[model samples]
Target: MAEAAALSRPAGVVGRRTWANGLFVLPFFLTFLALMVLPLGVGMWLSFQDYDMLGGYGGSVGFENFTRLWEDKIFLRSVLNTVYFVCLSTPAFVALGLFLAISLNDTYRRSAVLRSIFFGSSVLSVTIVTLIWRLVYMPERGLLAVSAGAVGLSSPSFMTTESLAMPGIAIVTVWWIIGLPMMLFLAALQQIPREVYEAAALDNASRWTTLTRITLPSIRRTIVLVAVIEVILQFQIFGQVHLITNGGPNNATRPIVMFIYEAGFRDWSLGYAAAASQVLFVLMLAASFFQIWIGRSKQED
Candidate 1:
């Protein structure tokens, strides 16, 4: 009888402990299920339905949304614009950030000030960044124009010209985002062993040779990590495009996110916008997987 009682006591204790642990994690798990999993599931369902007040949810149309999107000229244009922006902004930001990080990593004095200046870009809200750059890119009333006039040159309308608008947006994006990678790269640079450089110099390696052979190889992992992050972030660019261009100048600067917003909110086509969002999600997932594969391939080599 005593043996059975002892076993029961332990079993009850174990059950209680398990419940206690579950109680601690239950809130977070429930929150994730509600906020992320549930929304994603509903969004996926809505993507296929064609939900609109006029057209209404015409039920599951079997990939009609996907097909319709492919046939959409504006959608296609937006995708291309997004691709261009990502291609331009990601590389520029990553390269410039790495260069700045490498330069500042060795500086002893004023390093804090330089670091702050670079990092300060990331702290600015999207509205502030967009407003600031809008003024700079303005035709006659802007800094660029004023500078051109000072130099006895005619001012060009950067934002109004389709040729210059996308690039101008990209420049602002690069300036704002370079800060993140710069700080990350700076951290990575600090972790590199100083002895490695000294040894390279002892072997009579020139600065250029040392940089190419030593510094670069040592920082390859950091570069790859930052590059992947930059690519992902650039692909989803919305704020700058919306605030500055509103995807204007003949849809030249329209990105996928802005397109989705316009479709859902502006046009009141929630289902179509949801479809566009799913496409964007898939594209981003594929790009992320590709980056991971490249990183792994580099490691194997």
Candidate 2:
């Protein structure tokens, strides 16, 4: 009887633990369904039909939205712009972040301050960052223009010219977001065992060799994570352009997300917006899968 009672007590403890876990998990799960899963399912369905703010799905239009996107001029331009932004900004952030991370990993007093200054930028409200840069990018009285004039060079409109506008936006975005990956890489760098570096140094590995061989190889997972995250976030860039450029200077700064916003709100073309979003969604999914595949292959190697 005592053995049976002991078995029952173990089962009761297991049941209590399961209940506690479920209780702790329920809020997050419910929030995810409400905010993410449900909306995604609805958006996928809406992409197949004509959905507007005024009404629900306005009957099935088959692939008309998808088909129309292929022929959309603005949408095409937005796609190009987004591709350019991602290509240009992703590398800058990843490289700069990694460099700063490696440089700061040794942990001096100045390094702490520098890390705070760099990572502090990431915590700023995007609106505040956009507004500040908007002032800085001002053609005539802006700091950049004033600096250029001081240097005896002709000051050009950074935000007004097609050639320079997107690059200008890219620079601001990089400054704003580069810190996140930088901090991540810094943490990953700290996790590396001091013994590994010591051993490498004993073998006469140069600083460059140590970094490339020991530091990088150890932080491979973190690198992949930061790269994938930056790709996803920067690919959907909208707030900066919306505040600073508004996809202006001949739509040179128009990202895919900005395109969706303009179509839905500015153009009042909800169906077209939904269609464009579907395309962006597909592109993001493909990129994510490709990253995962590459990561898996690298692991195998």
Candidate 3:
């Protein structure tokens, strides 16, 4: 009976400890469920309902909202615009960011001032970045015009022109956000062992050879990470496009987010807006899964 009692005591104590641990985690779990999970669920619910009015949710319309997305011409154009911007911006962000990080990362020759000059624009608010670029992109009085005049070249207004507008926004976005990817790549560069470079130097490796064989291979994951992050970020571009072009000249720069905004707020098509948001959510999810697949594949290889 004593042995059975001893065993029972430990079981009781273990159960109490487990309960205490759960109690400690309960607040966090509840907060996450309330804040993140609840909103997501509500948004998903809202997407299916004809909830046009601000606080008035109507009956479920099933997949009507999703079906309309394919039929909506503006939404289709916005999706294409978003894809164009992503293609233009993602490579520039990844490549230029890596270049900046590598160039400024030399321990012997690195200058703080140079680093700050390159990275400073990134921390500025979106409005400030747009305003600054607006000045640079100004028709005749801007820096680009002034410089081009000095070089005997024509500087057209990129913001107003249909063909140039999206590309121009892409350039500004790269300047504004390149620092994030640069810093990320810089951190990854720092993690590469100094011994790797030293060994390459001992082997009489050229700069290009060392970079190709040693530097890039070592930070392959980081390059992939930066590319995926840039793709995700550029996909949701709204602020720069809105401020600079207002998706204008022909709605050429209108991104999916801007379309969703105009639908939800401007047109009062809440369900349609929510459906567009869901599509965006799905695209980002797909990109995330791709990143995971790449990581797993690299590990296996």
What do the candidate models score in CA lDDT, each in turn? 0.86, 0.86, 0.88
Q: How would you encode candidate 1's per-residue C-alpha lDDT over 114-208 as one tens digit per residue? A: 98888988999999999999898888879999999999998777688888888899899888867899988888888889999889889999989
Give candidate 2 regions above 4 Å deviation.
1-21, 54-57
Superior candidate under TM-score, 1 versus 3 = 3
CA shift at 51, candidate 1, in angstroms?
1.3
Residues forming the 10-long window of minimal summed lDDT in candidate 1: 53-62
In model 1, the clashing pairs are none
Q: Could you give me the TM-score of model 1 versus the true structure?
A: 0.89
Q: For model 3, give the 10-residue run with minimal summed lDDT.
A: 106-115
Q: Write the per-residue lDDT of candidate 3 for residues 1-301, one digit (tens) a residue.
A: 9878767786778798889989989999999999999988888988898987676777899999999998999999998898888889888988898898898897654455677788888889999999999999999889999999999999988988999999999999998878898889889999999999999899999999999888888888888888788878888899988898899879989999999999999989888899999998888788767876886687567
Per-model TM values vs. the true structure: 0.89, 0.90, 0.90
Assess the local accuracy of residue 115 in candidate 1 as a C-alpha lDDT between 0 and 100. 85
> In candidate 2, what residue range of length 10 has the lowest lDDT sum?
49-58
Most lDDT-accurate candidate: 3
